[model samples]
Target: MIELVRPHAALVEAWNEAHREWGPGLHEDGFGIGAEDDVDTIEGIQAWIARTQQESGELWWIVEDGEVLGGIALRSADDERVHRFGHIGYGIRPSARGRGVATWALGEVLRHARSSGINPVLAFCAETNAGSIATLEHHGAELEAVEQRGDTRVRRYAISY
Candidate 1:
């Protein structure tokens, strides 16, 4: 069974394994990993985990049977960054893709959003990401707009609870 849990040290090895599967990049969405964050060492991992407790947002790891599969985050709507990136961000490990994990994880996050009074949730994805687009649509998200952000065309979606 899939479960969303807070980042913890006990699962550091599993998390790193999943991270390695993604190779080197700062694009692991839902991890709340900034360019300044280094999750390679124990200290760095603990530091990143501690930072997740801050007010910016909440990050959860997608796990099943003690294995870290992915991560999903619900960003505070009040956050200024939400204006450009939207309220939700997520990414599944390449090995964990095509298993309805994103779809299920998104639903769970939306439930949390509803309880937090976020009302309508906004999500954005690359226009070329068919998997992400499908996941959002599966949750009844409607396209709000497609805007150009840097070199990528982003598709914005709004999901109402």
Candidate 2:
């Protein structure tokens, strides 16, 4: 019952609610937050969505029924840094965790990647994030390498389409 849909202004309220539930700083861009670095208004949120569309980056809401369970983003490999961090990132709501949401969401993202001619997507997680590592492994992602990012060690996984 899970599906991916493009981010839209209409979903701002729901997105903000989810953010509040998840605590602060869940999204890097501050989708619904009125922070100096994050979007402080509906118009700002709309502009952020438009920028994602125009920048060759894809952001989608992971929805079940009509509620936003979480979000996932996919973008082309733009530089060396992107390769190290992985092209896909995702987060599921706290209420929806341990229900296979991330595993299913990642499967859908990889399908889209394959359709777009990008085989074997890269996904990186901190070695301390056992849940994320397990999720990546569940999708047949192989441990490619481990690299140091700042003072933390990041495990890089390669998922083939």
The list of candidate 1 runs beyond 4 A from truth reads none
TM-score of each: 0.97, 0.84
For model 2, how does the per-residue alpha-carbon lDDT over 40-140 read when each residue is reduced to its tens digit?
46777677677766755577888887778888777776634357547788888788778988888888888888887776788888899787898899989
What TM-score does model 2 achieve against the real structure? 0.84
Point out the worst 10-residue segment of candidate 2 by lDDT. 28-37
Query: Runs in model 2 with CA error above 4 Å?
Result: 26-37, 78-81
Pairs in steric clash, model 1 = none
Residue 21, model 1, lDDT: 98
lDDT of each candidate versus the true structure: 0.92, 0.74
Q: What would the per-residue lDDT of candidate 1 be over residues 54-137, giving only the tens digit for each residue? A: 757788999999999999999987888787777899999999999999999999999899988886899999999999999999
Kindly give the number of clashing pairs for every candidate: 0, 0
Candidate 2 lDDT (Cα, whole model)? 0.74
